[model samples]
Target: MPAEGARAGAATRGTQPAEGGPERPTRRFPRITRDTARPEGGGRAASGAAPAPARQWPLLVVLGTVALGLLLTSLDQFRPGTLLIGVALLAGAGLRWLLPGVGMLAVRSRFTDISTYGVLGLAIVLLAMMAQPNPWLQIPFLKDLLHVTLSNK
Candidate 1:
């Protein structure tokens, strides 16, 4: 019984073969290997190295525009500042659409990015126009649209 138990334990661990059988290769969970030195040319790969910094001017433009808009609003230019913010968001959407490969701006899938930017911009612009004592950019359909949207009980 002791001999049988020993054989079973060894087999389960893959450490040693059964007493009377041929030796088998040890089953290692993780195999380790030595790190080889890099090829002589340089640390960089043979392929042309990619640019060190990401191109993000479009993203910067969007952010800077929004910051400017906020500053304007803080200076008591509410209407113009809101318009600027809306325009900035729309521009961001356009930038993303036009430059899909721009780094950092590709936070979400393309469709998601465009819709989010467009919808937020449209909402802001519409709300800003409607909030004024004398609304500026009036859309007849927008009234009916808001009525139907908000009238839901």
Candidate 2:
């Protein structure tokens, strides 16, 4: 057995640090870097500079519509608010489809974006219709669909 002070370290043949030296800096992921490339022409660049970023007008429009809808709803205007929200969603979908350059709006792929927007808009509209005291857009199938029985009778 070795002495207490004589600890058995790594079996260094020859190349090993004596005792005190500056520790080597280790590299880590998610490095923040600046984007300094400037666009040459007004259009999309071919190579060097980064591609032209997508426009944001479409998303802004959608957001503005939603804001207006929310304000109206807060003012006890249920019908118009619900309709406006549905319109906003639908319009957002149309914008995403027609104007491919909707920066933040283009979250998912083209097919996914359109489908998600369309489905969500339809659901909101349907829910709004059912929310009325005397729902004008009454569908027997939908009423039946909502009636779920969990009891084992």
Q: How well is each residue in 1-153 modelled by candidate 1, as lDDT tens digits?
A: 998898878776767776777656665663555674432221221123555332455667788899999999999989889989999999978876775354555566777888899999988988887776788878789778889999957
lDDT string, candidate 2, 1-153, tens digits:
564223223112222332454333334332555774422222221233543342455667788898999999999988778878988998878876776356667767777888899889888877887786887588887666567554345
Output the number of the TM-score-best candidate.
2
Q: What global local distance difference test value does model 1 have? A: 0.73
lDDT of all predictions, in order shown?
0.73, 0.66
Model 2 gets an lDDT of 0.66
Q: Return the TM-score for candidate 2, rounded to 2 decimals.
A: 0.59
Instruction: Mark the regions of model 2 whose C-alpha exceeds 4 Å error after superposition.
Output: 1-55, 145-153
Clashes, model 2 = 0
RMSD of each candidate?
10.5, 9.8
Q: Model 1, poorest ten-residue lDDT window?
A: 38-47
TM-score of each: 0.56, 0.59
